[model samples]
Target: MKKIKTVDAIGHILCHDITKIIPGEFKGVAFKKGHIVKKEDIEVLLSLGKDHLYVWEKNEDMVHENDGAIFLKDLTAGENLDFSDIKEGKIDFISNKYGLLKIDVDTLLELNMIDDIMLSTLHNNFIVNKGTKVAGTRVIPLLIDKNKLTEAKNIVGNKKIVNVVEFKPKKVGIVTTGNEVFYKRIVDKFGPVIKEKVEKFGCEVIGQAICKDDTIMIKNAIEDFINQGAELICCTGGMSVDPDDVTPTAIKESGASIITYGSPILPGAMFLLAYKGDIPIMGIPGCAMYNKTTVFDVILPRVLVDEKLTKKDIAMYGHGGLCMNCDICTYPACNFAKV
Candidate 1:
């Protein structure tokens, strides 16, 4: 049996001799045996009433002439199959003789990490019953084994997945630093701005305090939140390089360890990350309040899932442009944040 190269590939049945098949004027051309089907040629074949081909079903014997291998059913036919029913590990057919196949949901979702050359390396797709090959795997399409991909899928299932831009329950603490804001010489508008964004994440502001540029005061307020069981902490103002822009220093002055001080993202570039044991402390810049591109948006999702962020992770946001405050913020739907 030869290795099959593609995931989700389908084949069709050849009804006649290859040489005898006539190519219509509308049809691009006729194909011969052993001719690999491709993207461009698929439509031409479809127009010639060729629907099924010898699809790679893992078992060489199962790949009858003209069987489509990738497409399982006609989506336009209003017929849909639930992948959940297909089980989490192995690609199996309950009552059919289709040899066992491996479908990895994680890699498939993660930008088709497998390539054609690797996909061509696997041979079996249907051979086991549901749950029989719980860790069902393959190797024909590429170097990645089905077992590893299956494991990855299981990992995804076990972890708490968080989708950004969607309102989810969160516990937040706002630490407002700077003498001016702390002394109330100017109304604390920063607090309200942080509050609005926090509410969007379904966050409840459990701990809040006004601290002068003094590091000890800011550190104490952060500690209070940790003692009170705050999952996330936001420190607004005092983020610049000036003598008074001391939020970064304050977060470090607290017991929390800083993970990153800068990010590639606009509006939130001056953000800072610090962790104490497990609690996260964030230093949000003044830009966060006015530009809507503050550190809060970039790291909030990672905080929800407890992911550790590095400088490199923060650098990935540069591809997307600054938020234009468009009428509709179709994030997650549009990946506007581009994190």
Candidate 2:
């Protein structure tokens, strides 16, 4: 249904058989409107399966089918309200499965409801840093009441909203460091293997090099990648403590700062993270060549989005290992590897 008039009211519904239901047990409530309809209270209603609830102003369009409800006061049929009048509030678009949150302040400010501009920027999804203009009570939508919008803007006080930093993808350089593969003792499988994995992200391997276990050669290869505009670099093989193992030492000698030597994760505990300035230089273990997933799998997403990684960020992988490759894997639609 088309929206008609501006309004501000809580809309909700019973997910259960509310036709003959108790008040507290079956109903859900929410005050925020015009954005995503997801809320914890709605999940409880949907669990009942048989019951479906919706809330909307008597004069406005119905709440979204995906949403739970919209509460409205006494009004006659055929009357509607414009959504522009309703002040915008916290919008949570992150899916429950990912535990992630996406905040769009541009959409919030367009509605003329941001009261405390500074504090609202702190909310999850608000995510803007200092010097970023989040909202302005002074600016009002055309043809709308500036005074009313001003009143709604004042409601937002200095409540701090959490800022979530997002990662953006950077170009990567892959240096496959192994003699057996480089000298044709075995097929050049590592190159194609890593290429496929990196393709799943926004990163591109602009340069590739093959080097033996000589630290000097490896370090030179890394510098070559930096010269080629590679912000991220990966050295495959030679990660263990074998006498010929030199990938870890090579990364250290390249004048790049090491972020962490290893991670506490399965199938990828030997992973290494180092950086030259903000550019990350990683050492991928041999296991990544054969395994369906590994530490590179975890870091790829962060690298794609240019997000900073912390030890705690790496720790989140333990809960993520529950993934079992499905018969029909829906890559983007599923939470299998959006890490």
Candidate 3:
């Protein structure tokens, strides 16, 4: 591209957009790139404070911002992802299905480390509905060196940086324990809460079995669900260390490997996660019965996708794990479980 005085730029093609800003009323591109400058337009150009302008120089070694954004999009997009048309040198990634949005943070950081290149995305592991905007990519300048783009592609190297994993509606089983509920001394509120939470993630509650804090009965209920082809099992109540709490013990005796029994998250410190072969069984804490969100909400998406949670994964939640419990709750959009 070449620069010229605005007064002498008649007949020359613009190399970038000319923006017009009204204090509060409007802000938009007044003149688009590639538009041929006319003799009569000089006054308007000068009024927008254009003392000088860049004109297309048709350099084969340089790539325009629009084309650069498209190149970057191709390297970052993966399954269940779509992209918007390039505008003002920017392209947005969109989710084509309701699923979990995940980003290769390591790759994203490396890409942003490059000069004149940027890729911004949502927090990793966010649940997104169809048509959600997940990320955006663009170049910092009107044009970029082709060599720089080559370096970006080499860094990406057949790996997709952004993706959405489709959620499978798994059959779920619920085991509610506590003498207060099992003996009908109090209304059983835990079963309904757990059922509602899982169903929203496309999981079906096959059945709910209430147990009287008895390890044997809880274990039997868990095995029964496994025999019934329950892909996921949730055991609510009796998770604390109280002598009467036996949900954790029952989960351990149910032939499942315990991943972690506690989380760093506040309201869900007593949470437990285990796997019986490939089926996931969780000892849901009391927090889940009342709190709007918990560690269970953080781990639920991964479990729904059949991805087993690791001890390290649960440990990472120590940072930004405390929920403010605001009067107007905005989760998944807030910092909770953002690790």
Candidate 4:
């Protein structure tokens, strides 16, 4: 950078900030560093009593901060994601629809490791709504090596790193299994909980079945819902190992393929996930009816987005599967936070 007369500084990059002071009104930088001097800025600089200004010397091998920020935006943005307008070498990722937010964690780490390059994002596997800020990127210095950006681009290849899978509202069926509930000895409390949970994800509860512990009855109830065009089926209760707990068996008998019947998460260890054709069938444990957050809470959003789960996928959830059940319930805000 070198000093140049303010009048000649037009079309030159600013090497330092231009500070402006107003009595009792404002006192801050009027033009930030790295701002390219425009023909109009000459009058403002002269009025601020600036005779000379420091400006960057152009280099072909290096890119300006704002230009580098735009590169970062292209490398990071994917479908259902938008980027903020560049500001002082910084840009942020915004969601364009409500759905699950996913990131390539390994690639993100590798990009941040590059000198003068930075990218940050919310943790992977999160439910984000439209207009939510999910990630941000910024160049660390006013100028950056162009080759470093090429390395980032090479890492990105054809696929952008961050994205959101928009939720698909499904026609749902609820199967409440328990002799007490089926016989009306105890009021049907589980159905309301499951309905509210599914409805929150925009699923329509077409119908419900109150079934006894008998396997045939439960299996028939599930098939009945499938015959009625239920896109997703949720069976509540009788998920434990007790002799009377037969929901898992009934689900198998109904010809659905079980993905993972048990999870490594507390308050949801007995949770089951299966599918018949394209429809998802879940066996929710009793704890989900009482616990503010559980494995069901973690997995349901992915299901709504049509993420086909395997045993390996369910096993990967163990790392952050323990729900803290915080009193305030700032869920989707933290790894272990849930309502």
Top-lDDT structure, candidate number: 3
**Lowest summed lDDT over 10 consecutive residues: which window, candidate 2?**
69-78
Choose the strongest candidate by TM-score: 4
Better of 1 and 3 by lDDT: 3
How well does each candidate superpose onto the true structure, as a TM-score?
0.55, 0.53, 0.87, 0.95
TM-score for candidate 1, residues paired by index: 0.55
Q: Kindly report which residue stretches of model 3 are placed more than 4 angstroms away from their true locations once superposed.
A: 1-13, 16-30, 34-54
By lDDT rank, best first, the candidates go 3, 4, 1, 2
Q: What lDDT, from 0 to 1, does candidate 4 have?
A: 0.89
Q: Write the per-residue lDDT of candidate 3 for residues 115-197, one digit (tens) a residue.
A: 99899999899999999999999988777899889999989999999999999888999999999998899998888888888
Residue-by-residue lDDT tens digits, candidate 2, 1-339: 222212211243222223324567854333222333345444543454423334333432323322211111011001111111223322221211211223344443543343222212223222222234332122221112334334433442332122234435467788988888778687766778788777644457797898877899999999999998988888888988788998888888988887777776566778888778888888988778777766677676555556667667666656654445666644334454323
Which pairs of residues have clashing backbones in candidate 3?
none
lDDT scores of the candidates, listed in order? 0.54, 0.53, 0.90, 0.89
Model 4 stretches astray by more than 4 angstroms: 21-27, 337-339
lDDT measured at residue 166 in model 1 versus the true structure, 0 to 100: 18
Stronger candidate by lDDT (2 vs 3): 3
Per-residue CA lDDT of candidate 1, range 15-73, in tens?
22233244463433366543445667666666655554544235432322112211111
Model 1 regions more than 4 Å off: 1-168, 321-329, 335-339
Ranking by TM-score: 4, 3, 1, 2
Candidate 4: 10-residue stretch with minimal lDDT? 330-339
Model 2's C-alpha root-mean-square deviation from the true structure amounts to 14.3
